[model samples]
Target chain A: MNKEWPLWEVFIRSRQGLDHKHAGSLHAADAAMAIENARDVYTRRMEGVSIWVVESKHIHASNPDDAGALYDPANDKAYRHPTFYDLPDELKHM
Target chain B: MKNQSLIDYTLHLADNALIIGHRNSEWCGHGPILEQDIAISNIALDLIGQARNLYQYAAELKGDHATEDSLAYLRDGWDFKNLLITELPNGDWAQTILRQFFFSTYQYFLYQQLQHSKDERLAAIAAKALKEVTYHLRWSSEWVIRLGDGTDESKQRMEKAVEELYAFTGEMFLPTDYEKELATNGISVGPESLKEKWTDKVRSVFEEATLASPFKENNSAWMQSGGKEGKHTEHLGFVLAEMQFLQRAYPGAEW
Candidate 1:
């Protein structure tokens, strides 16, 4: 019931080879309890093999005001893509 | 276990799940906390799923057009075959744990025995059910210890539940005459062999939790096998009423 404790986001990895995906959020007095809560809430249906809980306040984010500056250029950066590379003849032969 | 008489056996299994699961489902949104609520609901849903399987099989065995819905909802309470233990309400979290622990222990051993049953369909169903009952055992055992050794109030309540819940085990192990005949003919399994493992399971949990088993002294352990014979506790009637209320009201409707 302590108001000072922060919310935490829950991520679940459904299978051994899967990446952790956001499942839900919960409030807890501490990180350990947060992880435990996440497990109870999100994984009851065998929904995950792994669980991660990040204290909501501890997670930093790009501001909405800065999204255009941070992401617009990356969208059109063709040089950063793998398609720009020419295939070597020896590699192709193998 | 005859193809014709299998209806009785199947009804007993369905009634056990429906009754016990209904009692457990009452814990939804009312467990000690959110985690416990989720755990209880998880087990409740499993029991209901299990009951559905049994009911469907029973209907098929009876050659009735009745689906699991009609069998569960439309039937009178006398038609139910669950033991009195399952009909006992969830008096507390401890009661719930003790009830589940007792039932799951019996179920695990029973299903394991049934896995090798001569009846291929029963064997297959038991094999699939063994996994679910195994998890139910784990969940119930964890809480039995936690509650038994928890705060003073919790410890007292859990200990009391252990004592009060004793007599019910007799009926669980009381293989009926029909069941005996089936076991003799290799159609059904006996509950006697299942009793040893159930005792061991209960003993280990009680040992860790430091709770005493129900006192055997002056206790009426020998009781009639009512449920297997189609008799039930008074609670079953109300449970049927509530469980069947909607289905009965809206007959032929699909959820």
Candidate 2:
């Protein structure tokens, strides 16, 4: 039997100014093929305007085994919020 | 042709699209790959949409002899006048592309000629179809080029495909008696003129794809006609069974 190619994570920007949200994942032979595969996999209905595909292996993440240690400290930093500062009239929506 | 004859002609063309579109729909979720699956289904939808319009026009032309549903659902496979190319089994991805590339090329030219039809209804439908067909033609042409030149495996399959598929392609532009009669009376365009345009378009795409221009590889007049005359392949009968099963089993049933 033939070996399967590695899987990649797919991210898509639905429109300009929007973040490249993680849409889904699919298997591909390489990065270039990944983007094309993502196009077919995720955007058949013309949902996204842009696509970015990266090998799932290339992504680094905090250790799920050490999750509490990585998260306990930042929980107390409420003072870091910018909510106290009022926006100017031109920036009212922000 | 007289108005009644013209309506028969339109129903003939419409039935071809309807049956083939129904046949293609079988591949929707079962394609070897997801992208290709969607692409084939998309083409099916396009053909079905086009058939809906043509069948409606046929009904109007007949002054209410048969509704679109009657023309589509009630008709036997023998009544469909589509070319043999569309009815050929989807042998493989390469074969599918070959059939699509050939059909879309003919469709593009045929619709272009149809856009100039004397009848306003036909002209309008052709104008709309011309735009969709342009995209279909381009997409199929691009895939043909890519697969034909991509690798040894793909190249061999594609070469085999072109040779195997060419026979069925000829029926597409063959002028039926109805097409001839309508053209003489100024209601529709003769399909003969579009043959050259189809040849030129197919030649360029084949050249770009690095495959032998059919004439370059082997000048074989591998044609099996009678499709445009409402005869069809064995595969068409099975396809009709599936397409008509729901409608046939429960007459006039709708969602």
Candidate 3:
């Protein structure tokens, strides 16, 4: 009934050799409880092989107001695309 | 009718799971928090799944168009052999968690032995269910410690829960006639053998939780029993009334 429990962000790795992706958030009294809560909430469907949890306060985010300055510069940089480089005929798999 | 004792044994196990699972399901949407709500419901689902497996085995033994649904929905209250502790009301969150911890601990050790049963199907079922029971034990144990060691009000409530539920713990270790017979044949474990290990685990957890062990105060205290023999608390009557209503009103009905 205590609504003041801190919020935590949950991340789950769906399988081996995969990176953890943001699943969602929940409130818990501590780290151990957060992990358990995340397990119940995010991995109930056999969705993950691993889980990671961090307090919401520990995660820093870039301000949405800076979206243009932070990401717009890369939008027109089509040269950064790997498709621009030609591959040798011998590199068939690439 | 070929192996009446075995069928009875299987139904006893199934009844325990189904009744407790039904009790836990009552908390589905009413949990104090959403995450915990899902957690208890998931545990309920696991128990019901175990019940289904057990009931299927029992039905096959009885062999006259018997099925798991019939076994679960058709039986009267007196026909059930679940432990009385499972049928008791979930008085509070603390009571429910404590009941789970005690029962899961008993099941944890019981299944460990059952995994080696002379019956192959029983052994296989025990092996699979052991994995789920392991998580239940851990989850319930952690909650017991948290609530027992938390603020004064929480600690007080945990103490009250222990007082309300501890006597029923004794019935878990008291084997019924069928259980005793099955134990002799190595088909199932005798509950008597599990008492020491269950007590040790509960005591250690209680120590860590800063709670006193009631068993230490009086090891020979009077305990409740008879559920395994089909006698149950009044609470089970209400539970069965609601659970069996649909099936009773409309026989052979299906979605």
Rank the models by DockQ, top first: 3, 1, 2
| Chain A TM-score relative to the true structure, per candidate | 0.78, 0.83, 0.87
Looking at model 3 chain A, report the run of 10 residues with the lowest lDDT sum. A85-94
Please identify which of the two predictions, 1 or 2, would achieve the higher TM-score against the true structure: 1
Candidate 2 has an lDDT of 0.80
Model 2, span B1-255: residue lDDT tens: 346668767876677677667767878999766655766787789889999999998877666467888877788877777787777787878888888888888878877888888888888988998877787787788789888878789899999998888887777767888888899877777777877788888888888889987864454676878887878889888877877788999999999
Query: What value does DockQ give for candidate 1?
Result: 0.34
Q: What is the C-alpha lDDT of each candidate?
A: 0.81, 0.80, 0.93
Instruction: Give the CAPRI rating of model 3.
Output: high
Better of 2 and 3 by TM-score: 3
Those runs of model 1 whose alpha carbons end farther than 4 Å from true positions after fitting are A1-11, A19-40, A44-46, A50-94, B1-4, B215-225
> Could you say which candidate leads in DockQ?
3
Question: What tens-digit string does per-residue lDDT give for candidate 3 at B63-134?
Answer: 999999999999998999999999999989999999999999998999999999999999999999999999
What TM-score does each of the candidates earn? 0.80, 0.79, 0.96
How close is each model in CA RMSD to the real structure? 4.5, 3.8, 1.6
